[model samples]
Target chain A: MTELATTLEALAVHKQFCEDVLNMPGGEKIKICQQCGTCTGSCPTSYLMDWGPREIIAAFRAGMIDRVVKSNTIWLCTSCYSCTVRCPAGIKITDLMYELKRLAIKYDLAPKDGKAPAMTKYFIDSVHKHGRNHEVELMAKFMLTKDWGLPFKFAGTGLKLFTAGRLPLFAKNIRGRDELDKISAYLEAQEAKAQ
Target chain B: MRYLYYPGCSAEATGKAYDISTRALMGKLGVELVELDDWNCCGATSYFSVRELDSFAIAARNLAIAEKQGDEDLCVICNACYTTLAKTNRYMAESAEVREAVSGALGAVDRTYSGNKPVRHIMDVLVNDIGLEALGEKVTRRLTGLKVACYYGCQYSRPMGDFDDPEFPVTMDKFFQALGAEVITDFAGKAKCCGGMMMLTKEEGALRMCHELLKGAHDAGADVIVCACPLCEMNVEGYQPRVNKTFGTNFDMPVMYFTQLAGLAFGADPKQLAIDKQIVSCDRVVAAIPA
Candidate 1:
């Protein structure tokens, strides 16, 4: 009886993995994925992903969380909703990908030199500091911290937009930032509990 | 109809033309767009990827302010803002735990979100509130010779699926026809993804995807491709030159926002519309339009 119980406990990997993803807001739909390759077929950027939409779900179902988190699939998702719209099982595949992205960043599993994670960090940092996104500041910081050489690569287009007065130099903050801070803090506490 | 307009951060920068033309067209159509004061960022695609509940909280703060303003409808121009704000609003209303947590957050700022008001995109209000026939009557200049390819860019009708067919949307095509342009109904790039946020990370993939879109529009013989999303505009237009160089294809497709074309049809000054600010020159579109 003790040997049987231990064997049954060892078989709970799939259930354990499923629960991890389902804990996200829109991630419950992954349970209904059906192993269909429709999502992979429908994805525009699937050709570029290490694991397409279908494989991401498959890997997650098989308790390969580490592999899925470290893969480029989650970061490459354009959030176009094509797979979500096309899924016959009504699975919100794109939203589930977003959940994986959040997990990857939280766990520091994201690639060190990955531009996607770098851009995401810079973007969120921009919003966290200023009430609004200061495009100039975000780009400046991203290039400075992430890849100092990226500035020269984008100089031509940057100069054109600057000359056109489309890229504003000054940062604009919303009026009620104190309220935003309160809300951010409240939600952060809730996120800590979930983690 | 009075709406609490949220132009978002991009509307003032990369989408400056969209902002100008949207305001002009709204004013001309007699639609009242009251700016939502002290409104913050919707956090775009980045914030949520970092923290889930915190992303909701930040966006909810904006919705909370809109809710406080007498329950008027919240109108957004940029697709990212529309999707994020509406998603946050719907999520808060649907999930009990989400509502409680967001409510707790708002309470700190002395606010509440009952989810009474509807969050709408510019296209929704343009087609639904101000009907197509009414909009057709206000067109002072007909874009008869212009061949337009309407590009919805994946976010407008998908996921939410509120307004039109997600697979093949014709709302924008219909609107362009109502404005007297020859709308290309068969363009394959209409509902295709522009690989928006991926542009910064996966440049090669994004460029390849954008090149496909440009080729489709070019092959469809479109004079211009109009999009509703700012990121779509940034991707298709900003990356056109690189795509051309990479593919050895000189596809100089002028990607314009639907609002800019609507502004043209409404006979507003092209300068007022900031038509020239577009990365891809709209000179061909301007030449085709009857002055």
Candidate 2:
């Protein structure tokens, strides 16, 4: 009887996972995925991903959300929308990838080896700080914290861009930068109230 | 015609040439571009990966400002910005929950968005609004024999095929053809992803993608590859050495923003187009165009 109760509880968690995905904007179309390999076929980075978009959808349907989130699949997505455009079932696969990325970040399920999450964090942090993303600052911060060898790899192109005046050292802040904070605070309050 | 321009974050940095040339080209075409006042970042794809509602809210802020400040459509040059802003407008119109959340966020900032502002790509405005026939007539220097590859890149017409075919966009090609450049219609990597910001995160995947794109242009014997997106321009042009190093292939293809090439075809001096800023010098192609 106890084993039955635990099994039901686990099933409920899996059911909630599907519900969460379905609740995302345009996420309801996951039900009609058709198991076609078009998305995986269309993906440019799927070769590098552990599981392609088709397999991710299949795994999610099978209640392997834990594995799906932990895998490098979602992080590998470039958000190019190639899969979304080609999906015969009309699934927004790229947006679904973004949602999965949010889920991974929210639950601390992203893989440790993945740099995309950290890169995204730094990008958003740059926007929050300067009201714009400073490419040089973003790259410097990303390299110092995430990939130390990046500076060496980027040295050549960096020199060329710098000489051409494309790599600006300073980011120009927008006048109404404080509005971002107010917007975020209001949304946070609304989310807190909803919870 | 007049439009409110959103030069995106890249316009101030890596894509400065695109912005400079776009303005020069538009001025030559007799179009007016009013820069959006105090516009913040669009939150981009990175923000979308972190917080969905926050991403929509921040992107909507730009639209709200555009609505409050202007009656003309918001003209975006970067494909990522174009898609992000347009996508926010789309989700707001389609989902009431999204509409409510975005509106509430805007309300907090003492602004409002009616979700009716049209977000247009520069290519769409160039091709559809200003017909190719008119554009052809304005070309003071026709690129008669210049072989060009019009690299549309991802997000130019994807996830929202409002302007052109998502998988196979031809607006850039058509635009180039109108300028008398021989467009490479069969370029395989025209709409492929350039790995975008992945160049910073996962260099290998991005390098491989750039290799394929460069190889396609090289194989087509393209004198120059024109880009519509800032990231795509940076990747295919700036990362050629990286791509060549990884793939063990020699690729020196000159990648220019479509506006730069258009500016060139319009008799604007090479300096006006910031042609010298290109990593791979376009001197050869510039010489090829029949002046």
Candidate 3:
């Protein structure tokens, strides 16, 4: 590949990042981040993140879309909204994290080590099938496919909850479960038209 | 007063006690709750992480039903559902693109949402609409000596602090006080995150967060911790042993849904309130409440 073509391709990713963030609700506020660390400070799990909220903003400004998408920071977010409420710039940091997560999944850039994406996929699948999330089914699928040791670790609590009748064995399918599929189909067509 | 209730998916399973107690408590308060017919999942945080438009559409489906089914405001028990549905409303009102996409999706499903329905938290309805004075009068057995750490968790008032302070909510505290329970107003972890779904995806981070919340309630000398969200209740109560195992600390705390405790105060039977469903026995806290 020629150097100029490679440069333009890199620039396209940066441009796409900006456009994606700008399209989100309250996404424009990302440009006003003061390089302040309040978001990271307020983040309960920032210590475990590969890139804290503050650093993510800085990276966004630096046009390092590749780096941001490849990091574990977005997946680690618990959607607590602490950073969004605490940011002095009025930036919706949590929303920004969600956008990044979507981008990572779209480009197939999500780290293999991140279990959040898998959990999210299984969760959505459950919703698609039953119109509501079946807790026992979702947990069982995730534990079996993702973490084999979870059943053993959760056995005591699981048995107790089961005895209490809190853990039901069957999922209740809503009457209008097909309505969800229709909604998805419509949205997919809209996206295709946009593209 | 009547309202449409959206019991998020958890209420059917892990949070059934919350559903039972809420119904009993509201019934005693003379507030009629009509469950929203054919409600689906709000997609929670999981949906938005992958597809934003789909999340808004699914969440708005319930709102659309609420608009079609009744004139009453929608009352939501789960914080995540409240936030997701409220968020769809906010985004629809703010962004023309979101409005267009969501309306198109809803139209395909033969439903429509005008974005005018109010999505409310139960605590908000109890404290604001029902009035604390009225709630106080309904209490037959006052929780005179109970020390309650009201854990708001995240999403209770965040990103849209319409009803309470996003950072430090006092609605639960004030609600408990009205029932004559001793409210721990200074609990540091009252509005902190309890790991939510991360408890399954990332155990270490979630366990650490739960540890802090449990420790805060313990330090406040709380006899019981009352939660506003099911995920918070599960993480703090269901995983207390896991938290202790990870943190190497001995902590035994009874975490109940705020409605469960409120039901007891409203003179509802313990069985009716589903108090037996709690993992950590609330028998101590129950005995402490004056008969």
Please tell me how candidate 1 rates in CAPRI terms.
medium
lDDT of 1 by residue, B1-291 (tens): 789999988887887888888898888788888888788899887887877677787888788778777567898988888888888877887788778887888887888777656889899899888989999999999999799999898878877877888899888988989999999899998989888877767778988889989999999899999989888998898878778878999987888999988988887877888888887789889878987
Clashes of each: 0, 0, 0
Q: In candidate 3, which residue ranges exceed 4 Å CA deviation? A: A1-14
For each candidate, report its DockQ versus the true two-chain complex.
0.64, 0.79, 0.85
Query: For every model shown, what is its TM-score relative to the native structure?
Result: 0.94, 0.96, 0.97
> Between candidates 2 and 3, which one is better according to lDDT?
3
lDDT of 2 by residue, B18-66 (tens): 9999999999999999999989999989999988999999999999989
Estimate, for each residue in B92-203, the C-alpha lDDT of model 3 and write its tens digit.
9988989999999999988999999999999999999989998888789999989999999999999789999999889999999999999999999999999999899889
Q: Sort every candidate by lDDT, greatest first.
A: 3, 2, 1
Worst 10 residues of 3 chain A by lDDT: A1-10
* Chain B superposition TM-score per model: 0.97, 0.99, 0.99
Tens-digit per-residue lDDT, A133-182, candidate 2:
88889988888888999778878988999999999999898888888888
The TM-score, computed over Cα atoms with residue i paired to residue i, of candidate 1 is 0.94
DockQ of 1: 0.64
Candidate-wise lDDT, in order: 0.82, 0.90, 0.91
Tens digits of per-residue lDDT for model 1 on A1-195? 011113555345434445757876666777777987999999999998898989988888776776687788998888888998889888878778877887666545678888888998888777767888888887787777777765675667677778777898888877786666677777777757865
